[model samples]
Target chain A: MADKVLIYSRFPKTMMARFAERFELLDTGGKPAQDVFSGNELAGIRALLTAGGSPLGAEAMDRLPKLGAIVCYGTGYDGVDLKAAAARKIAVGHSPGANAASVADIAMTLMLAATRRILIADQYVRSGDWASSRQSPMMRPQAGMPGRRIGVYGMGEIGRKIAARCAAFEAEVGYFSRTKHDLPYQYFPSLEALSDWCSVLMIAVRAGAETQHVVNADILKRLGEDGYVVNISRGSVIDEKALVAALSDKTIAGAGLDVYQEEPHAPDALTVLPNVVLSPHIGGHTLDSHVAMQNCVLANLTAFFAGRPLPHAVKTA
Target chain B: MADKVLIYSRFPKTMMARFAERFELLDTGGKPAQDVFSGNELAGIRALLTAGGSPLGAEAMDRLPKLGAIVCYGTGYDGVDLKAAAARKIAVGHSPGANAASVADIAMTLMLAATRRILIADQYVRSGDWASSRQSPMMRPQAGMPGRRIGVYGMGEIGRKIAARCAAFEAEVGYFSRTKHDLPYQYFPSLEALSDWCSVLMIAVRAGAETQHVVNADILKRLGEDGYVVNISRGSVIDEKALVAALSDKTIAGAGLDVYQEEPHAPDALTVLPNVVLSPHIGGHTLDSHVAMQNCVLANLTAFFAGRPLPHAVKTA
Candidate 1:
């Protein structure tokens, strides 16, 4: 008999197909646990798979009396209540670094797109403005990557990758994290210091209470008029209102964003901005990233069902 | 008094301001030389400034009998009839490698944007498709850059820079050039072989009669269904009609083009395509690149008037 794993998030059928082959999944269809499953059914579930961003609280964990594992499908587990899980003795596991390269790739994509004003250029060509020889203010020459300073907000897997890529473009790389690692990049003690020194600030920090809205109006002001921000991390890291204001009044040159304060929906102000380049939250959404993450999820689940420690368990303080 | 220098090509007033300070520029306002200037005015012009892509055939050269030097304002001098210039003992000069970094940056921008389907993602967010949780075929997870094969068609300055940037993203780099240099990348013997080996083909070859329409139907076919091509070089290098056919039929995945067979006019067929990311020959249009090219032009012109060898003269066999 296959081990029953509760799917607490609504994932596309295609993404769940492989897992379905290995486990009997009791899907909640993105609803409350009690709404979709009876007390008996919920009590019998031993493990659950969830998107890293979905809210999973202690109360929900209590419904599954037999739940021993909480497996997150991506690098992040921000929405998982770590204290609650720990009190319940639930082993929290996540696919750490599985999506780092892909996320870093998106960061570079967004950075290049925003800095070079590629979206504006594309529109200029598509609208026949180029053929007609029409002039555009946005068509003004932009500074290239060489000699540009790129400040990274976090120095984790994705941050490190971003730094390496920026360095390759002949740009100077700097970072501000909780602790400095022995890397080639310059280390800053604070985000403000990093922002002041670099022209482009890349947000790659983990989303949490400490990081939420850390990049506020002050930071944007420090970034100055010629600076740009590229966020591939959680959108909550930036104060969206401040970003909108910065972009609007030219406090900052522009922004390229993949994540937002609200997922799936970016603000109307941001979408309508000519200088900004916005994309659906897809930093870690590559095929290779998905496969790597799934492999980790499968490994964690298999180990949990076997009454063993999770092979990819997240270390919590 | 400033030496007479004919402005043979139409440039924006701002771009010409610095040149005007040093030369007695007879601006034609993009009109035919005969229409804009009298024979006497044309005869006095000993040196001229031109855009690298504008036509400067033997007939145009013949009109300026005292034309001792032809200074191209950018890296390319393809517009100049080299044979005619050599026969007339006219020294041809250009800003060699002046815009290489900027052009390479654009190439990377286009490659990342097309491969990641960034435009579609941007639209998904802006159009509220993401908020509705609507699925898009274009939203399917894409292959990231790491370990991906990038074939560079030219091993010049721009090509080398592109390879370095791609390598920093952890992509496998390969190349095919007329003469192989001691570079770190794998060198293929021909463009066909390089296309066969790599998924992304970057065209950076010089544009001339010998290389006209080099990337045709057969080459695009070789690139295969999952392949992408990016051209920062001149457009005559690729057969546009064949490219349209290949893209329409999904013979190749997509293309990122900065130049076209016709200047200032991209084909309606190309502009309408979703897979192609088009720019209006803005590869080397960065302010830094312009300043670099102008400096080279200044040096070339100053040397020409001083009866010294053109400092940045293009050697003719």
Candidate 2:
């Protein structure tokens, strides 16, 4: 008999089909499977497939008498209820570093877009503002990436990848971490010093309460008028109000934001500002990444069913 | 007494002071110096300063009988009447390879922007299309640079620099030139073969009658639906009509265009396309590049006045 797996989100079609072969997959994209789950179907589910955004609360945990494992299909397990999972003694696993390459790609893309004034240039061509016979209307030259000093706020997997790409552009790379790694780049013990030393700062730290508002008005001021900030990490890491003020006052040159304090709703101030490039919090949501996440979920469920330690077990407590 | 030099276009402010020290300068920006030139002020004009777009015609060449040299500030002296200058035994010098670094930067920028769908992604965030709490709307993962094959249409200075940048991103690099250079990348004798082999093709050849519309419907078809085209060279290099049709029909995935077919006006066909990224041909217009251009102009004039061989002298006729 196949062990039942309750799915809380949709995955790549192929991977979902693969999961169906291993276990009887229950579909619940918007909400939990309510109708069948209220009966014996709920009792049969021994594992849950969740994502970074889908949490398994204690209330729901109490109803699943046989639930033993929770598999998350993204680098971040931010939405997972760690305490609840710990109380129920359920194994939790998440795909770690699966989307680092794609996320790193966006970091550089956003960096170049903001600095190059890509939006303005695109708008310039579309608006028919260029004189037919004259030289293309001269716009400000970009503060290009080459030779620019870049500071990475965190030196984990994604941060390391970002540094590597920036270095390839001939930009000097630096990092701010508790302790330095075995990298050739310069390291600063404090974030403030790193901001002062670098013109472009890339955020790639782990998200948690401790890291909230880590980059605030003072840090923005230290970044100065020629400095640019790129955040691919959690939105709460930056105080959005302070960032807006800094952008408005020219305390910093510009910013490239992939994450926002208010997801989906970027502050209106950012829309009007010509120097910033904004994207919906999709630093890692590539199709390649989506497929990778599904594969990770499969590996986790397979390991759990075979009475083996989860390959990427996330510490619950 | 200093020899006279006719300044055809505006140069950087500091460079003007540098020129003032070397020669008696004459400014004729909008139209030719009609009144002054007809006067004896043009009598000692030993040299003329010309740029890529601002040409000195046979008529103007005849007026400056004493002209011994033509110093161009940009890399391409496409506009200067080479045959006319040759007839009078005039020394023509242009800044070659001064723009390689900056132009290479834009090529990669366009490559990433178009493939990543950056402009559309930026618009999506601004348009409030992403769901606030759910996973940010899934976007197609760009056929990212890593592990992808990139074909350079011309193996010139700018093309070599672009290949280096792409290799850093882990993309496999190839090239198509009249003849292959001593490069590690795979080389094709024909553009069609190169197009079929690579997913992304960057055009960087010199503009002339022989190269016009080199990438037309046939090349686009060979590149196929997954292919992307990026042009950083002359606008006339690619067939705009064929490019638009390919983009419209999804025959080619996308394009990143820095130059256009019609001087300053981009076709409306390109404007409505979601997959194309357009810029007003400012690839090498950085302030740093401007300073470099001034330095080159100064070098040519300095070498000419000293009766030494011109540093970047272009062969005329």
Candidate 3:
């Protein structure tokens, strides 16, 4: 008998077809698989496949009594309640290092965008400024990143990648992590100290209760009037209200934000602020990256059901 | 008696006062003495304190027979004919390296602007797209730059500085120069070879007959489909017409230009293009850079007249 599988998030048909080849696959089309777990839709389902950012709450875990394995299809498994899943002896696994390069790419892009004033210059050109150009005739040339200091908060894999890029720009790269790494660049004991030293600060730490508001009002102030801040990590990592106020008052030079505190429904004030550059949260959503994340999920699922060591077991319990 | 000094460029009051105290300063209120060079005005001036970009042809040099020293206020003596100046035994000095850091900063800014999609995203928000945003809602997360290869055309001081900035962004930097330097990064032998390897190429070489259109159609095509070109050097360094055609056809990714073939007026086709970013010729004209350049020019003038070594003498005939 095949292991019954329920997919809770969107995936390419190719991946779904691959899953169907081995398991008793059921496509949820990103709908909440409450029926499958509640024993109403289908019984004896042994596997659960879900992507990151899906709501797999305690109630959802309690319903899936027969679920032997739960595989997260992306890097962050914050949405799922790990303790509940662990209590049921359900093996939880999440994909890791799948989207590092792509996320790193986006981080660099946001930093560059914030520093260069690219968006502003383009709008000036587009608003029929050719004949009577406001910026062209008497524009101040932009300050580039060379000889500038760049600070990275949370020197994880993504943070390290960003640091390498910042280093390439001839910026003195510094970092603030919980524990110091054996690296040549200077390590600040705290984010506030790091922010004070850097003209451009990039937040690349994970988002959680402990790491939430890592870049709070105090650290923001330390960034100073000529400093820019970029967040490519998680929305919960920064205090969006404080960021908006800082930007409005010109306490910070600018911000380039990929993820916000409340995403999709970003604060209306942030969108209106002239000093901020905003992007919809899509850091790890590249076609190449998505495929990589999906492959990892599939590999983990395959190993779990085969009674072998899973490739990326989350160790949630 | 002290040599009669003619001031042509507009400088700050503090700088002006400094020059006045040192020489018999003749203030022309930012206008280059077209009449004075034609023997129509200021006929008895023994020394010329002119800025670069002043048209000093053979006739102008011939008219100024008493001109013992020609101290240009900036680099690039293309405006002042070196052959003519040398024939008249005029000591031509220019302010070099004074504004290099500022210009380098702007170059990195332009490159970052082109790579990061700053203007495009800014317009998306400013155009009331957030509330009724089509791109944001259905968008897969986009990628930005990290681990991208950046090519610098000239490995001079400015080019080296730009490389340093590229490093900060985690960019793998390479450069093509006539001779190799003992730098930390990789060096390419030719522009074509560099174009083949780099996604973003920066032009920072001196502009003249020998170096004109160094980035031509062939090299641009070699930069390939997803490449971006940034020109912060002289406008003559790039083939503007070819760049426009490439941008029109989407041959390369995009371009960020600060200088143009014609000052004040850019090509209408280039101005209208969506993919390219344009700036008026303000690459090295920042307030800080201007003051620095002026000081350098003053120092060159003071030293030349005092029979001290000229600070920034232009190597010319």
* lDDT of model 1, residue B41: 94
Q: TM-score: which is higher, 1 or 3?
A: 1
**Residue-wise C-alpha lDDT for candidate 2, range A201-289, written one tens digit per residue:** 89989776578898999898888888899999878899999999999988998899998886657988887787898887667766677
Each candidate's TM vs. the true structure?
A: 0.98, 0.88, 0.81
Ranking, lDDT, top scorer first: 1, 2, 3
Cα displacement (angstroms), candidate 1, residue A30, comes to 3.0
TM-scores of chain B alone in all candidate structures, in the order given: 0.97, 0.86, 0.87
Model 1 lDDT tens row, B1-317: 99998888878778888988998899986678889999999999999999888889999999999999999988888889999999999999999999998899899999999999888889899999988889898788878888889999988899999999999988999999999999999999999899899989999998888889999999999999889989999998999999999999999999999989988889999989989888888888877888898999999999999999999988665
Q: Of models 2 and 3, which has the larger DockQ?
A: 2
Tens digits of per-residue lDDT for model 3, A177-246:
9999998679999877898899888888866668877787888899998889988777888888888899
Off by over 4 Å in 2: A1-4, A7-45, A53-65, A81-84, A132-138, A315-317, B1-44, B53-60, B132-138, B305-307, B315-317
Interface C-alpha RMSD, model 3: 4.0
Per-residue CA lDDT of model 3 for B1-317, tens digit only, reads 65668775544344566577667877765555664344544677657776565567778666556776777765666667788777777788887876776667667767655655555555554565643544542243323445688899998778887888677655689999989999988989899899999978999886666787878888889988778999987778888899988878878978888777765457788878766777655566555666777787778777877878677788652
Model 3 chain B: ten consecutive residues of lowest lDDT = B136-145
Residue A91 lDDT, candidate 3, scale 0-100: 80
Docking class of 2: medium
